[model samples]
Target: MSGQDPVSSPARTDSWSSKIDTSVAHPARRYDYWLGGKDNFAADRESGDAVAAAFPTVRTSAIENRRFLRRAVAYLAREAGLRQFLDVGTGIPTADNTHQVAQAIAPQSRIVYVDNDPIVLMHARALLTSTPEGATAYLDADLRDPGRILGDPQLARTIDLSRPVGLMLVAILHFVKDADDPYGAVSRLVSAMPSGSYLTITHATNDHMPPEILAAVGDADAQIPFQFRSREEFGRFLDGMDLVPPGIVSVAEWRAENEAGPRPSAAETAVYGAVARIP
Candidate 1:
């Protein structure tokens, strides 16, 4: 047990999930519940319901945010010509993960996913399945500790930071709060990347919502602290970087022309997204 690979070992997976205190709500599980996933527990459902009660469009917001993640990764892999990705705060493995989307375009693409949740770690094996020509790794790390993530040996072995890589902060930074200096942490990671590197961010915002809509939420996401920012504040995170076309639009409208159905309105989604290059 001492030397076993936690991600690939069934016993380790059970060990990890067993340690989770199901009585309390967690961000990862809450998010999973909002996305109609079965991995969440009663506490997560309770939390999700509270948030949804306030923001009636929350479930739609969650779905649209995921779509932004997929489109951003595809653009990085296909359009930006990036083969390496560092996706921090990657939640539960879904239908089209970062590696799945990237490797579909470039079979040789490499990716490293980082998340703090033990449940996410339990599912790490699912995230690790990569194309034979490519490679994938998971780091059980927290976003607050950028140093640990940036300097991790597991990450170093998977993707070379000296080369261009895609840095994904999708829907995770808002949880960090201003006290943690999310912007500074982001800058540290950006500095580590080479000039051609790209950053993709999708964060919840109250900028589009009307006054009553903002009041409706009433801190329903209390289980996890969220600093709902403005469109300008979200854009500040990408300052000095070159934004991709249709910059900093609602999550639902970002390159959604190819999507099947009509995109949700900005106020309904209430999430700002953008992809920018280091240049």
Candidate 2:
């Protein structure tokens, strides 16, 4: 990660701080709490604890999902030769962020991160680190508003729309219920990218878990709505795109690396991940 602090532009502080509601438990904060991050509130911790109690492997699943993200980004940067990235639903910053992984392999890589959480916006500086050769920017936007994201001038300035981009939707689509037209939202985002662009997704699934476990998870997630999709349903998100090798498998099973050592069972991971290319 670059040592520079977040951009200190006055535009970032306009109305963003007032929109923060710490009283409610947000998915991003709850995710940070699960990853042992300090940028979470008491409500987030309580919700995270409840979810962990219901699903003992929730933390493991989170860790494995993060590993999947690193692997996917490295592949896009090193193998696919992608120089631009649009990472929507970017959670709180952690080790090997998208820009870090991409810039490490290709210093000229430019990345733009999008998220709607107020806490995430506050911590956006941690994610804005850019290499001297590359650039990074954070946008406070929701996933449902693909048009707004596609039209954002900052995104346009950082990433060239004509070139191939790595569109990362990791662990975020599940939050968009069916009523919100998640499929349409994804298609709209994909449509904005060029032919060579790549889409990497990791979504929670209820496929491998037992009924009792699913019920418990459902109860725990009652505080905040989380729609766990089936494997087939999750696969639909990649429609019209050609999946990369080892298509749409459990998070731990996708390109299992020797560095990560032994892999966990699909039931334990409980998340499906894949990388697909626009044809």
Candidate 3:
């Protein structure tokens, strides 16, 4: 988990049409479609519809995951006294983005967003809007290559490595299969951060889903497969960090703002979320 040499240049041209394959369904684009975004194609809609058909709660899961992200960012900035953030696997920009949430709490908070998707890069301007007091930057990098993300010049300019940072990996790790060594990749990123930094995650899980629903979702033709983990397996990703209160609960139960109204059950949400601090 030691630091790797920085890449000389990590920026890429923002021309996404050449890079994006409209014929195939991309996970990010499909997620965008699920979230009622207009940045998706017919393929994405088709795939997303198929998955939604299989698991009627997929849309709910996506929306709840987003809510979890907003709450986590607010907690990190306001409660945890954090000012720097590294949000990897950032999908298409939507409401209540990481920078927006953090900067709202602390105007001077700095953020660096990382993603390999060409579509996300095309929409990077939406994510780069920063308040005069704070700064924001986007890196066209992959999650598997933590070195490239950690070493990018843009990231270095925005976030200070010596200070505490909020590391966000929401709804993304399921894409990293077991063979890709997701745990090792996450460790490398966490190791690069200074002590007191926090890690926030919201991941899809089958631990609480009914067998029939799981079977239906499993039969969907998502071009890229989702590797749903158990609650215990998801907790392992936060191994070296100290868990916050109400540790590793369903997304709906993670320090929510309101609990008076009826809410989706854990089985319906099918997502796990948590925040932990580096000791």
TM-score on alpha carbons, each prediction: 0.95, 0.95, 0.93
Tens digit of per-residue lDDT, candidate 3, span 1-279: 001112211344334557889999999999999999999999999999999998888898898899999999998999999999999999999999999999999999998889988888777777888888888888879889999998888888888999999999999999998999999999999999899999999888999877987887877854786799999999999997899998899898898857445778898899999999987
Residue pairs in clash, model 3: none
lDDT of 2 by residue, 1-279 (tens): 232434324466555678877887889888888888898889988888988998999988998999899999999999999999999999989888999899999999999999988777777777887989998888778999999999988898899999999999999999999999999999999999999999999999988888998898889889797899999999899998999999999999888765456788899989999999997
Q: What's each prediction's clash count?
A: 0, 0, 0
TM-score, model 1 to reference = 0.95
Which residue runs does candidate 2 get wrong by more than 4 Å?
Answer: 1-15
Q: What C-alpha lDDT do the candidate models reach, one value each?
A: 0.88, 0.89, 0.87
- The parts of candidate 3 lying over 4 Å away from their true place are 1-14
Instruction: Return the lDDT, model 1, position 191.
Output: 87
lDDT of 2 at 4: 42
Error of 1 at 204 (Å): 0.4
* Candidate 2 accuracy as TM-score: 0.95
Per-residue error for 176 in candidate 3, Å, reads 0.6
